[model samples]
Structure formats: structure tokens, C-alpha cells
Target chain A: MSLSITVVVVTTSTALHAADKLIASATAAGFDVRVVARTGDDPIADVVKVAIAASSSEYVSIIESDGWLSGEAGAVIGGFLASHPGADIVYTDEGTVGRRGRIDVIAKPIFSPERLRCQFYWGDIVLYRRSLFDEVGGVDASVPGAELYDLALRASIAARSVEHIAKPLFIRSVQSDSGLGGIALESTRRALERHLASTGGGVVRAVGADGVHDTRRLVQGEPLISIVIPSRGIYSEIDGERRCYVVDAARSIMDLSTYQNFEITLVLDSVAESEVISELMAIVGQKLRIVEWTKPFNFSEKINHGVLHSRGEFVLLLNDDVQILEPEWLESLLALAQRPGAGMSGGMLYYKDDTIQHAGHGYYDGDASHIGLDAPRTDPGPLNGYRVEREVSGVTAACAMMPKALFIEVGGLSNLLPGNFNDVDLCMKVTWLGHDIYWTPHAELYHFESKTRDASVHAFEVDVAWGRWGFRMHDPRYWPYPHNRPPA
Target chain B: MTEITPDEQADYERDARQLALVDRIIGLEAQVAHLRSVNTSQALRDQLKEVKSSTTWKVGRLVLAPALALQRLLGRNADKDK
Candidate 1:
């Protein structure tokens, strides 16, 4: 196929140099560049349209102003599109351009049209024939933030030839100042429902039939994970003095067999005693990391601070109390967490006596004003977590694996929450945004759960049981009360 | 959205291939276990037991997982923190 993938950058009056850098990068990759800037109040669609018309190529790709295209992006993109002629448009795995340039994660979508509805999230880095726009239609120019997802869904449904490359090639800039804005996601969900309803449900059948990388499957090329065991105090309440177990946590970590990629994250919390730090250093040997945190008590706070100091994308938010149950715990967890729609994922929690602690989470409505709570006790042998792939309302944050950005996006466990409800709050907020939470039975961890010692030991759980309404306020579907009885 | 750079493309391909290799190795392990479990001859069972202990697999795995995990740490963003 004779293809010249021309990148179209729509520049505002200001960002010319950044736009030029993108053009130069694309040019270096042997792609033709066409600049589409604001021309006297012309709509952005009109601009993109004129640029697409000007490009005399079989395939036209797009790179917006303040955008990035990594090394040799064009050929890979054009090849994906050419190979899949049924696809109307092509998109690469979208993420951010951090200090390291590109941090793209596996895109795993679990809830299809049933619960979580749309995938046309970012439209800027998509590649398609110029004729696609000319034939069906183009961006409406009237819709707001989610305009592209809407337009692309329409075009994709109409043309049925839209496709995507399995590589990470795009970065949708983080609008730092925007926060979550005033838009309610439930309202967006309603709008999406209306849109989906309007198009008579233009959902595509067989999402991974194209034979490119399946969006639901996790990519496997990353190396082993190495964690830094920070110099945190290993204090046991059993004695006034600090302690280490017969088999230390660091040594236990090294014992894991499914260990292709993993690292320990050791942080030197300011409060950790020097003796304990020294002992940890002795235990970890080369694995100890003396990280800096401005002194925080909450487990969520400690983990958030520690992760910022972490190197692995697949982070293990392990508590000092938990031990690996089996050798395949990690690979099993990663395999499950790698599934689509799983933003914050965790697994089966068991007690030292081998009883189930938590297989998944729901909000506690009984004793608390909506602190995150685990699913009411279930027999671990029956494998409640292993049932099937389904959307969950919340998950235990004590041993969750999620993207660092998603953690930051949820405001890193409200500093005001101080204790028990923080992880609940984080999971609720995540699910509220229409993302799914999952619990897998395969990744079992022994949780030495010390709720009393848990920094979030709130009197509010007792108070809420007396009067206040709890988890019912946000999503009543996940309310857990005192009796452990299902709401009849 | 970002385009998949060639480096990332190569990385994905490599990761996929490595995971596939592990999957295959696991299959072989299961097959060996199955054959040993249903041994027809006492001599064959004894040989299997000896081979299970004497096989280079245990030593190879003991050294590899930690080493791989260490190399993986260098690729992460928190190399300095740990």
C-alpha cells in the first residue's frame, strides 16, 4: 500500500514552537506535516477538515498542538490501518507524556455495552483516510469535552472500518487546573445512554476480532518488578522492643516463585526508628530505600507517598502484615488486574487461621458513615472472587494495584479522612466515574489485619449505626449494614 | 492520543513472547507432573522422583526470578527511591 501518514496539528496563535517540534518529530519519522491553525474564528472541525483536504495522502494522522508523537509512529500506525481495512479510524494506546516522555499502560476493558459503555475516549491521535470524514461526517463542533468520543462512535458505527494500533503513541495532556470540574459523571452516563439509545446502540460486535492486540488482554513485555524496602520501623505490639520474624518480610518477598518482574519498595518513614531501619537494612541488604515523606500516619497516605517514590507501574500496595500465600500469587494477580476496566484491582484476603478476610469490598452502612468496607464474610474454599469478570463497586486499597495517575486523580485518599474510610472513599470515587473494580481468587494474600492499629480507626462507624445514613448516599447498590442480611 | 512508538512496539512484542514462553514452560511442567502421577512402573516412578529433584529447574528458577526482578527495578520510575 502506498501510504504517506501526514500528521495534522491544530495550533492556537501561541504554541507554535511546541507544534513545530511535533511536526519535526513526525517529519523525522518520514510523515508529511500539515499545520491547521485558528483562522479568523473558524471552528476546529473546519480547521481539521481543511488540513485533511490539503494532505495528498492515502492515510492522514493527527497530532494536535502541545501534542507528542514518539519515534517512528507513522509507519506503525499506517501499517495497522492498512492491514485492517474494515477499520474506519485507527487509535494508539493513549496515556501521558511525563518526565520520562511516554508512560502507556495496557488498555483492558471489562464492562462492554452493559455497564461501562464507551471507548472512543481520546480523538486527537487517531489515524484514518481523509475520505472517512468526507464520506460519513466530521466532528459536530457543538458538543463539549466528550465530543470526540461521541463523534468517533458515530463514525465507527457508520463506517465499521475504524481500527487502533496496539502501541502507546498518544498523550492527552492533563488539564491540571480543571480538577473534576462541575460535571457529574452520572450525568455523563445518562448522556452516553441517550447517545447510545439515539444511534440504536451502534455497538460493534467481537471487540478483539481484528487479530491486533486485544484491548482486554494485558501486554506481557515488561521486565520483573523490583521494590525498595524503605527503612520503616518493624514494631510488634507484643513487646516494647522492635522485632523481625523467623522469616523476614524481605526474605519472604525473595521466596516468591512467579518472579519474572518484581521489586520491593522500602521507604524510610521519618517515624521509623533507627534500630528498626538498621534491622530492615540488614534484612533487605541491597533492597532497602531511605525515602523521604513529611510524616503521615494513615496507611493510605503512607502508601501514596511511598508509591510516588516507587519505580514499578504494577505496584503492590502490600501491608507489612500480609505474606504471599502461593508462588503464583503475583503473576495470577497481574494477569487478572491486566483485564480491561480494572483501574484499581485487588485480590482475595485471608487470615492467619486460613479464614477469608476479604474477597472484595462494599461500603459499610451499619457502623460507619460510609467508610470503605469489605464484602461480608464468605467461605474462601468456594472461591467467591473467582466466579466471573464483573464490575465491582469498591476494592481493598491495602493491597490494590492501579496506575499512579489514577491514584493521584482520586486525590490520594483525602487527608481529612485520616483513617478507615479513605480507601472506601477512593474506591467509591473511582467507581462513581464509571470504572470497574475487580477481585480475583487466584491472588491470595494473608492479611494480618489490625483494624484497631489501622490509622483510620474511626468512632464514626459506631455513630453512623446509631443514626447517620451511610453508603446509601453515593450508590445504594453497595450498602453493607450490621446484620449481614441482603437488603430484601 | 499517543502513537505507538517503534520502541514500545518492540517492547510489547518482547513482553508477549516472554509471557508465552512462561506459559509453555508451565504446560511442560504440568505434563511432567501428570506423567509422574500416573506412573505404570515402580522403576519409572523412582526415576521420575530422582529426576524431579536432580533437574536443573529448581536452581535455574531460584537465581532467575530475583535477578529478573532486580533488572526490572532499574526500568521503573522509582529506581532512586528504592
Candidate 2:
């Protein structure tokens, strides 16, 4: 099969050296380049059409003025398209070339159509099948700030197959003064509102000035959420005094939580004193349920048992070591999870001293690495992804919430695999059945992590995980290759 | 999209072949690892069980608690310095 691709450079006016670099890179990759300049009067989509017409290749890729193609990107895209002929649109992982040197190494997941309505996870380095492009009527010229998003949405709807390459195909230079402008936010809200109405019903609202969007799923009355926490009633020293994790976590949920309609189910791996149980009952009254597990410690089994007893519409798998920092945290999580196509929703976990514990789990080097692990709360991780609600391969089950129906559909959690990758396995299983896992920074929590458990993974558990899902880890939907770590 | 000539087409063919070969090699390595894991996993599981059951393990974990605390303290201090 012939691997043919044309490079389209969209620019108002190209920087001389930058253009030279782009031309050099394209030539090196054996791809022909065409420059498409905007006349201020015409839409950007018109400029794109002119560029596409300039070449007769099977695949068309658009490069912005501040972007350059990665080495062998043309060949990579061409090969991918040839092998996967059904794919209408394909995009690759990208990074930014900025004043602080190359940053924002955006390692994107596989095609997430629902997430496209929320945030743009895929950067500008996209390859389009000319047929699909023409079929979708190219990009919507009306949406200047969200032109790619609008085009992507239309293309996604029309596409029989959508693909993502694990490799970084393009590098964008950061614009210092640029942010997701007012026009972009408004357009995004409009697009999302349309998306929600079509996919069910929801309200899309832009929160604050940070380009943060809240896609509030239409509540079918006040749904009951069952918050499950696996507890040992473990004590740890905090702020010069010893405190029980379960007590603190329970206290936070009972006091700090603004969401009223919820139940707390404590799955105990250890026996608690009658006085302790009585004290907890006195605090929470009839809202709490305690289940004893005399068997061996299997995190998955504990959760499964909890879910069996849960009566709520939604189940929140929470760790006893976490404390809710925001009053609206549960509300935020439920809002995102309740959205269409959401398999699971997780919050950004922070350390007691305010460094990040978990933002999202990124697959790297055959294991799950926590994106924004140990970074400061203020740090805007790769492409400011840490600051927004977007789709990820998976989120830690520590604070993940999903509908009870979906949970049962995916078979709760894997029983064979205990500890480490069980949550990841559950996520992969859920995603395999076509669902988007969303991670949001809006729901914040302070995690006293590795406090209750020894945090040890048995070798059998690791092998089982690898045997079952290692083949699919490089699928870009789960784990992308070149496995770049998110910036701190 | 631009038309590729015979010469550029040949280059693309070579690049595609190389990528395909790399992917195959990775797949083969994964297979080998899986086979080895199948042979060794049971013994490793037993070893893990034994270690967890040992008094030495309990003592070691308890001894490491203060070290972890100090390490966290230093880590927070370093972040503050930054």
C-alpha cells in the first residue's frame, strides 16, 4: 500500500525561520508541504480547503504557524491510515516548544467523542481522511476559537472509525499572552449544549475565568449516592497528634459535604470496639452501614461486598485516608459522572502539605504512573490538563464514582487481581465496553495515602494484570507510547 | 494533499516496513515476558506470602515509618524552597 500524506500549514503570516524549520522537517519526512494563508475576511476553514486542494494525497494534516511536525510523522500517519483503512480521523500525541523549553508533552488517549464536548484533549496535530473531511463539510468557519473542536465533533459523528497514534506527531509553540478566550469559551458552551441535548440532556456552564467547564447532567430528581470506604480504623500522626483515618474521613463527609443525598458504607477489614462503632453511629445516625470482613484482605472483594449492600443509584469508591477539602466536591464529581458516556469520575487528590497525590493515571513503562504526582497544587500540568475536566485512560478508585448499573455491567471489579492494578483493570474493562473515564480537578481532596495499607503488590497480581491487559496497554486509549510524564 | 512520486513512495514504504518490524519485535518481547511470568508467578506469590507472614517484615515496616515521615518532611521542605 502506498503511504501518501500532505502537510497543510495554516498561517496568517509564517515566521521566516519557523517556516524554514517546518519545510526542512517535512522534506526530511518525505512529505510535500503547502502554505495556506488567511485573508482576514475569510474563515479559517476556507484556508484549510485551499490547502487540501493543493495536494492529492490520501491523508491531510494541518499544522499551525507555531507548530512543526515531529520526525517521520508523515510516515507514521500514512502507515497507520493504510493499516486501519476504516479510520476517518486520526490524531497523535503532541508537545509544546515554549520559552521554558519544550513543555506540555500532551499524551492523549484514544478517541473519546463525549469528552470532545467538554475539553480538547487531542492537540492540533490531526490527520483527516479527505473523504470524511468533505463529508463533514470541513470545519465550521463560525467557531474561530473552537474551529478544530467543531470540526472534530462533526467528523466524529460522521466517522465510522476514529483513531489515535501513541507517538508525538507535532510540536506547538506556546503563545505567552494566549489563553482560551471568551469567544472560545462561548463557542464551546454552545457546542456542548448541542452535544448534551443530542446525547440526552444537560447544561454546559463555564465556571470562573480559567477555561474550566462544568457539564451538569440533568438530575432525574435527587439521586442517592453510596460512598464506600474500605477501613481498618488505622491511626496516623497528623499535625503533631494521632488521628484515626476513618473517623476523619467520615467526619469530613458528614460535615464538609454540601451534597445531602448520600449514604456511607464502611467495609471494615478489622474489628472496631463497640464504643468506637457507637460513637460513629451517634455522629452519622442512620446514614452509615458497617459490614465486617473476617476474610483475607482483597481490596476488590471488599468493594464488591460493599456494592452488594449499597442501595444508592451511584457508588463512590473512596479511601478512608482522604478528607474532602471542598464542600462542593461530591457535587462536582456527581455532575461529571452523571454526564453522558461517563464510566467513572475521579477527583484530583492532594497531599496534606498541598502537593499532588493523583491527578490522573497515565500508563508508562508497563505500569501506571500518577500524572502530576507530587507536583504543587498551582502547577498547570501538561497543556493545563491538570486544571480541567477531561477524559483519561483511568482514574484511581480512591474517589471514583460511577452509576451502580454501569458497575454491575462491568462485573464490579476483578476478583483475581488484588491491590495494585485492580482499579486500573476495572477501568480498562469499563472503557473496553465503550465508556469515557473523566478526571476533574474541581473535586479536590487531601489524601493521607499509603496510610491504611502496606501499599505492597504481590508478584502474582502484577503478572495477572500484565497477562490480561499488557497487549492492549499500547492501544493509546489506555496507554500511549513514548509515555511522556506530565510536567510538574 | 500533495502527490508522492516513485522515489518518495519508496521512502515511505521503507519507513512503514521499519515501524511494522519495531511493533512486531515489541509484541514478541511481550510474549516472552508473559511466558516467563507464567513459569515464575506461583513461586513469587508464595514468597510474597511468606515474607508478609514473617515477624522480620513487620518489624522492618514499623522501623521504616519514622524514615518515611522524615522523608516526607524533607520533600515538603524542598518544595517550599522551590
Candidate 3:
């Protein structure tokens, strides 16, 4: 038996020619074609509904007037649907075709709810199960420019399974523009706010004109956060002056951070200088708890010891070389960590020279590395990856946050990895247990990396990590440019 | 034979190329899974090597060697008596 698809082309009087071309192409490609005329009187959503109501098919695809089906869209979509039997909603990678040919190929990631809230990354063409469309009540006519976005959010909430096809199946006949317009941005913001309100209450603030947003989930009551820092109380030369990194880190948190209901658990080396401890105490005041590390220099072991001594609902793993850059950095991390299905949350870290240190971790080309390393902090990166809060394969433990219970549940960091790749191993463990690790640009910090210890990676550590998680070396979320873009 | 139009030919070639691309993507996904399985096997072997070279394993072997020799001697004596 074959699955049937109805292609509903929404068009206006001026773009009827393009609509005709789309109808012809869809019909030739073995899809049921329906055309809906968007008069100035009726809303676009109502017009689409009329067409959908008239058509009878297993699947319904909504496309704009200027968009047409690719030559092999039918074959690819059929094959995908056959394979993914449980998928209720499916969207494909899309590109714009002009006289110069195809360009701006948006190779979308596998169903990211966080990314969806920030922007309408899913382009114009979307295929939905007819039943799912009806279940989500078609679309809201009130959201003028973001009708599809609103529908998508509601459908995602109700969808049993949503899948993404990396292949570009939809072709638009115009050049894509940068950023959402005024009305569109406002509509998208409203849609996002409603999405948050329906799922869980959160306030959405538009970050920039590029359709990026910051979502602050209403955290229920102030949860005491335990910040665990493993330090040797060593001094680093900054601007020709010797400064204790741990003391400075503690001072930055005390002075800069807006969240006050927290304590700092410093896992100091037993042989640390008395002056360093005294400085840390004076800076952190009564909120500091010190735990002496008598064992050898094992970063994972020290963190585990610190967590054992501290008491908080959540645990924040901070490196001593880091300084808080934003007043609301902790607030951003905590809100995301408190969300449902979140295992860990991390922040963007910059180097001393204002270059990106860690945006997130990606296991590309069979090696774990930071996603956007050494790039200017102002760069919007590929697919706005550095600008939005989205799910990642792993996050650096240097500035990561998670529930204390979850930390103990994943057995903290692995002892086998004493120093290097311990964070990656911990992230892998969290992902293995089916929890999402999120990275947000909203949380900002500066990491004076490798200030206290040797940063060289060892061969044995690589062997151990690859031996355990070699299968998961490929990251699906890190779809950067040149990899996803079509031939120019 | 029926003559095919140039436009129809272009469509056919385009569709064929796209279908091939889809097939290639599917093939790559399967290949990645196969490679992952192979890598996991190699990793297990490496872990086994590490365990075998561990001090605890060496000490266990040393302590069990004398017990095994006595058991062999006792077995031979019992067999001779029988």
C-alpha cells in the first residue's frame, strides 16, 4: 500500500503563476495538489484550513505560493515516512532557488525544541499527519505572520514523535533575507510566549534582531545552589601581578553574581598556602565551606569530594580560573537546569582576550572539541548556534550546572579519567541515561584556561574514552557551515 | 520509440540525482552504525588488555598458582591409589 500526500499551495492573486507551477510540479511528482487563494478578506490560516478540509490524504504538506516541491521530494518523503512509522510531524531541510541556482541551504538539526522557541528555523515547507493537524486544531488565525510557527509549537507539544529529514526537499523561488521583520518578530515572540505558557510558565525576551531569544523559566522557589570548585589555591600571573585564582573566582561570584541563595564549596589541596585560604574566606564570607583534598591531583576526585561535603538542591561545577561576566549568569543556568528533562546546563565561556573558549562540545571527526573555539564573541556562528540556547552532545565541566541528585545518580565524573575528558565522559553518561544537556549563550563567563595545571591530553585517556564511547563520536547538533550548505 | 521532451529529460535527471543523494545519506547512516559497532569491539579488546596488565590481576595469578599445583599433586596421588 502507498501513503498519500496532499500538497496545499497557499497563494495570492499576484503569485498565482508561482502557485500554478507548484501545483503542476507537485502533481507531476505524484502528490495530490490543492490550491488556496489568499484574498485580502480572509486570514491565511483560514484559507489553508479550507484547502485542507477539501483534501483527503494521509499526509498534508503546507507550502507558500513561491515554494515548490523538489524533483525527488515524493520518493524521499515516502521512503522517510515508511522508515519512521511513528513520526506524526516531519520537516525537511530547505533552500532557496534563484537565477543563480540553489543557495542558503538550511540543513536543520534533529528536532530541537529549544531552537524552535528562539526562531522559526524550520522553513516554509512542513508535512504533518492529517490526524495531528486536526488534533492541534489546524492553526491560529490571530498570529498573522507566525501562523505556521504557532501551529508547529502546538503540534510539537501533542506530537507522539517528530522527525527531521536532512535532505532538502522544498525549493523556494526567491532569495532568503536576514532577520525577521518587525511584525514577524512580534508575532514570533507572541508564539514563543504562548508556547512557554502552555508547557511551563516562562518569560521570553528578544535578544537581537536576528530572531534569537532568551527564555527565563519561572523557577519555583529559590533553590539553594552548591558551587563546587576544585582548586590548588595556586597563583597565576595576570598583567605582571601574582593573583590567587580561587580567591579571585570566589570574589567575582560574590561581587558580580545576582543570585545570592548559594554556597561555595572549595576543594582545596591540603598543601595550599594559608594566605590563599584566608583570602578566599574573607571574600566568600560565611557562605564558604572548605574541604581538604589529601589525595593526588585528580580533578574528578576533588569535585566528588566537594559535592559530598556541600549541601544544595543543585550543583554547579566551576573551575577556579573562571570569573563571572554577567550578573544573571547563575540565574540563566539555574532556570534551564530546573526545566523538565534537563540533565545538565552550561554557559558560554570566553578566553581572556575576548575569544570564545567553549560554546558547547562537539564530537566531530571522531574527536571531542569545543564547537566554536577561538572565534570572536560577536560572531553569530553557523545557524546561530552560538547565539541561541540549544541541546548539545556535551558541555565542558568547567562551568556546568545540574541537580546534586543527578550528579550522584550519574556517579559524578568518572575516576578512570582523572583529568582530561572527564567532563566529556560525564556528559556522555548523562546522555546515555536519556537526559538532555543544554548550552545557553545567556550565561557568560571568562575562563583563564589551564591556569592551574598542564592542559596536555594523554594517549591513554583517549584510548579509554574512545573504547567506551567511540560509537557516539558524531554530533548531530553541530551542523556548521560548508557541511550543511549546498554548492554555491 | 517515443520521443522524450528536453524539459521532461531535465526533470528525470534531476529526480534521479536527488534520489541518489537520498540513497547516499541512508547508506552513510548505516555505515556509521557499522563503524560504531566495530569501534566498540576494539574498545572492549583494549579494556581487556588493560585489565590483564593490572597489578590486581597479576597478584591474583600469583596467589592461585600454588593452590592449583597442590590440587594437581593430590589428584595424581588419588588416581594412583585407585
Report the TM-score measured on chain A for model 3.
0.92
TM-score of chain A of each: 0.46, 0.79, 0.92
lDDT of 3 at A335: 83
lDDT of 2 by residue, A120-160 (tens): 66667677788888887777777765667667767777788
lDDT of 3 by residue, B4-69 (tens): 468854764464344335333433453455566786778889999999999999999899999989
Selected candidate, larger TM-score, 1 vs 2: 2
For candidate 1, the clash count comes to 44
- Which scores higher on lDDT, 1 or 3? 3
- For all predicted structures, in order, the TM-scores are 0.41, 0.71, 0.81
lDDT of 3 by residue, A377-460 (tens): 898887678888887888999999999888776767766678899898788778877899888898899998742336667787
Proportion of native contacts present in model 2: 0.02
lDDT of 2 by residue, B16-65 (tens): 34433533343345456557656577888999999998999999989999
